[model samples]
Target chain A: MPYHFYNTISQLRQNEELVLYDRVLHFSEEDEQLVKDFLKIEYETESLNYPFTPPSCNAAAALWGAKTVYTACQLILYRENKEAELPLLLPVYNNEMDAAAILSADLCLRFLPQALQQTKNIDPDDALIAVLENHLQQWHYSGIGYVLNAATVNFDTVFANECMQQLYIDRVIQKKDMQRAMLPLLQKKITAAMGIYSATFWKELNSDKTHE
Target chain B: MAEDTSNHLVYWMQLDLVHKDYLAQIRHWDNLKIAADEQSIWVKDFTTSQLESIVLKSIPFTHLYYCKDNLLFPKSSLLPVGKQPAFLWTPIERALPVTLQGFNHNFFGIQQQQALRLAPIEEEQKVTVLLATVQDAGNYILNAPSIRLQQLKWIFINNKDALIIGEPVLPVNGRSYWQKGRFIFPVGYAFEFTVLEKIAAQQIDSTGTHLIWWIDEASYCLLHPDVLQPLSIASWRQTISNSPHKI
Candidate 1:
């Protein structure tokens, strides 16, 4: 009952997701270096204090890493199964703060996989949602989907329903909107599964903002 | 009437004559003394033999005609038969006299008047009276010695009427003809003909006629009228027809 454990620690430690995501995003050498340096710092610091724990060691780092991974996977999925899914998750932010918060979240998400590998016993899904909720209170309303995406093992009905309820209570999502967004993935109408998490995450955020 | 088989290309330009009174005013008027001013005056100094030597040596033509302005002349033609003129004039002493005594007519006086009278009457007078054949005319004029004249009017005859040719005017600074720069022909052949102009002994303000003989498309000479003679057009036709070679 570790919440939605899909990848083993060894697989997460490989950082393959992050590497492929960097390639997909066409990150410049400097940007890649920056992200790598940030992750290495976060991991080294977090590992020094909590030698056995990963997801629980640095909530900020894990969340940033998870968002980054989720964004990359979403873009990949959008490229593959764009015709079926709702067109959400575009890089449009409300302002500079929103853009920066999203960037920070992506960086946190980028570190999550490796963090997950290091942690001994922590529900990654619960830990990630907690970090995203914490960031949501402080930062502008963006990047919530990426955090949730990193927490869930895949974009399944249970995870989507839970994410929809949480966002609704937080005033980040509108009522009666969860099914239209989650149906494509539930019915297997969405050809690509990689981006399902972030896609649902952003769609819920947009729905909340529309109702507000 | 007959097909002109000569490979030579010729065009004639009428030579303007200085008035008889104007010729009298300039006492020492000679071919070498003629400047660029009086170029229209007829030159009557060249002898038939001198003209022949210059024409034959410089130009490759067999015969040259010295005809009158009144004669019914055929349009100038370049027949597709003969060889290009290849003769080169040998350099001679530069102090030769302009007038040669071998002529049988008072060519300068009568012909000058005829040219003057014809000047207003006919369009032919306005055209350049040139007798050209496909020959190396440049070599002859450039290498031949300078000929001195008292007046620019020099003429020759082929039995019926007078034919006129004159020398180009000398540069004003009394510079030797050799110092006056070289003349280049259109045929890309260049020689120092001005070196033959006798400038040291005589200096006059009179400009004489500047005659151009195009030996070929590219080769031609801007010479004094003394360098060429006008042959009878009829005789030229007869000679070409009679010759074994079509030139």
Candidate 2:
């Protein structure tokens, strides 16, 4: 069977062999259209603020998605740190993100957190940890579940896009990243959004901790 | 506390000042009732024993939200007596993006009326009680309820600017509907209530359907299409001086 990006990741997630990433893999025409439709629909369904702008053409977007998953999985399973080569393989994303990029990357990124957790359990200091973290900072939406350096985010770029900022806050809340929730700007937005229902909505969140 | 002799449901308020809101229930008056009293809320012993001994103030709706003291009728609905009242467990139909006027206190009835405007209700929903209908909402950007009588619990929990029906921040279990570039919970009554930031409302009511905004019988307001505001008693009489819309 032709390699499906999610299925490939699922295999890796189950500790299956790393055989698929080696092939010159490509999704069929039907799969590319499916990827495009999913990203478009999800952007509208999860309205953050701004409108969705496709990152590139349909094929390019799908390819980037496949590449992101393969690379993240390899980084998790392989012994060598693939840090230097990641940028060349999946060029550093532009400062402003497209709905396509975030959603496409998300197919794997959402699952990446749990997979990485297993690695941490086995080897906390594994070289793969640092490599995957760099990948996360580049794709901070996925990093919602991972603890990465927030300072490394391109806020100026993200804030420029209302959709990105809203989605970021949403993902943060979705992930329940206490560290990010404590950010001054984000705390205000989250508080205002929750209004009087903080007790019912996000009960565990302690606003006082942000001050310290 | 007096023993119950009527089938009418009784409710009490519990305040959680830390959250600036409270819950309602069917329990006996406790410290929370004492707190409610400090806010000038009147409570009744509710029994055949003292019904005539007290001064029974006139209220617009009785048995609907029965509370007694020496003076003042209830102005708000009570919360669930248990997790919710049995009647609230029964759901009915309501249209969403509807504006709703609710009782102010957690469960205690206050004198002043509190109205809350909810938005983007695109269609009908199954809720708990019918409360009261606006009859004429006057203008439409909105919708009301056969509301679950128990939503009285959240009468005061303004959690998120826009409610996600019942979803929390994490959408892992959320069933929000995707419409016009935003996510919405089709139902206002949720497992509990979850919230999100408000999104742009669906364009104004094109159908001119008669939408409702539930108002408790504690007080009443009629909307006049001419000025798009709630008509007071005098104004209601003036508008209907010539029209048959008057009761």
What is each predicted model's overall lDDT from 0 to 1?
Answer: 0.31, 0.42
- Measured against the true two-chain complex, the DockQ scores of the candidates, in the order shown, are 0.00, 0.01
Clashes of each: 61, 19
- Residue by residue across B1-247, what tens digits does model 2's lDDT show? 6466566434322223332211122222222122222322323333443333322322222232343442223335344222322111111111011347886667665576433333444455543221111222111101111011112211111211111121222212322322211222233422121232221122222233322222322222222223232322222223334354332
Any runs in candidate 2 off by more than 4 Å, and if so which?
Answer: A4-62, A74-91, A94-100, A210-212, B1-247
Top-scoring candidate (lDDT): 2
In model 1, the Cα lDDT at residue B104 comes to 75
Q: RMSDs, each prediction?
A: 38.9, 24.7
True contacts kept of 2: 0.00
Restricted to chain B, the TM-score per model reads 0.16, 0.16
